[model samples]
Target: MFNPKLHAWLERYFYQPGYFEIVISTLLLPFSLIYYCLVWVKFKLAKPVKFSIPIISVGNLILGGSGKTPLTKAIFNEFSNKYKIFIILRGYKRESKGMQIVALNGVIKCDVATSGDEAMEYAISLKNANVIVSNDRKIAIDKAISLGANLVILDDGFGKADIYKLNILLHPAKEPRLNFTIPSGVYRYPKSFYNLADITLKSSDIIKENSIIKPTDKMVLVSGIANPSRLSFIYDRCVGYEHFGDHHKFSKFECESILKKYNADSLLVTQKDYVKIKDFGLKLSILELKTTILPNLIDKIDMFIKSYQISDRIYSNSQKGDLC
Candidate 1:
């Protein structure tokens, strides 16, 4: 059981810069050296698979929540019916051995605890769309194609040497894009990794302009996410906030704590945080961010896809149905 305080301290050091940080980073060089070597070997042996379908990856260098799921949802919304959209995840935190296909009809079901929290969130959010989780992304893409999917969206996959073409990198808003290694900071790789990006972007501006919640209402901001600050920025003037871990499971005691902690007319939440406490038995007025992208996002993404190599099914969005 990791305490919230330790998580907070790690998150603080994860972003802050100091002499100790420099020294630790220096010590961590050997690990990076090993990672780089593996990358090199993987690069040498890895054969870029050319799929009949166009595989577009939306990812980040950070270790956890950088809003990639929201962006993926945005992309899917943009092209779901317009094109046959299939989403693939690496299944980061999930627990199964073999690959699995998640099908949620009226009930919400997922493999998040094993597949990873982010992947689970994506599975739930895009319930209407086809979501698959597999370790080998290329294998997942192949499976999607077999299932009649024309376009596959690689959720949170980048620098993945195995998948080629149409790489879009996600950067956090507050964090400066630099060469900080993992465990020390959110970055999974170095700043040089940005070189692989076709479109480099910050999540802050995107969230401010597009999140669904309105600023006029008095609401309690409840968060159990990796980057609470980003969500805080969106709900700055909210009456109160109850913070939790990245994937915290709220006990009955904690739910009671929330009820005792704040006095507000309603509650506001990020999609990530919303899922955790939704069934908490507290009938507070709840609000959620409508996942979407900035204006002209569709046009830009479409034009970029046209330049890539994909099959005819890629453009066949003529299906007379919504995301289902």
Candidate 2:
């Protein structure tokens, strides 16, 4: 299949949805329906395995850019002091991964290639929580429990049925209220599964307000993420942009070309994109947009922890301090 061209079509189809998408997505709707049905049956046939510790999942039905990563950090921030926590991700598009450890107590060991961009971002972002990369989440979670994690959080794990967890689906503010299944649209799960979410959250709830937003005379928005538009705020002053496929590994030549193509004096990227290329040693000035997981959601999560008896140890008075 023509993957790149299809991806471009999808971007327009999902975000703009004019006559082009109306016709294209309609023709592709049957395929999306079949895929969704197959997935639904797969989940139904699989048995959910419960870990010795609680596994909380932060995910979304939409394809990407729903703020699941920041929300995961938010949950991590809430319980890191009290629980032995670890994050499990599929290490999407990573070179090496069969249950690799990325971080321990906030210290990262592996390069971004061993751990995908999102996992590496978590490793760099969280100073205390451990991050693990594996396509088979069961192996990762089992490893986490063995490594003394009382809680294992799965990132982008909405489709994994092997382990049951607290399902938190994030809805981005900019995302349309309703969405369709993939191929035709960005929704991976049918909208009917909306009721499956234990709690539905708005991405705006976690988006940091004072996000880095200094405008420049000439800026090139550089990113390789599922939903690059989430960083649209950076475009307010952007002269041009270059978006590689999600989790794309950047080469020195590519970075240099992006600079030349846009004739950009400075380069701007999201934290997720920054981790992948921070070591590329590019010459241009790079600015990163930071995301903060607000504190309001913590109250609801804390209550769930207590209700389910997940843990009693919250941050002590001395530890009770800041929000990320």
Best by lDDT: 2
Off by over 4 Å in 1: 2-4, 95-97, 104-117, 176-178, 183-185, 203-207, 210-220, 234-239, 263-267, 284-287, 290-300, 309-324
144-257 per-residue lDDT for model 2 (tens digits): 888888888899887887677888887756675226688887788887776878778774565554344444577788878776656666677788877777777778788888
How do the residues 1-324 of candidate 1 rate in per-residue lDDT, one tens digit apiece? 546677665655667656765677677777777776665576568677777777788888777677777788888877877667777887654567556675332133454455455555666677476777888877777787887887888887786777775778877655742365664345666666788677777754365334444434666776667766666565566777777766665576666566566755555666665555556665444345455666666666787667553344444443424443
Q: Which ten residues in a row have the lowest lDDT in candidate 1?
A: 103-112
Q: Give the count of colliding residue pairs in each prediction.
A: 8, 1
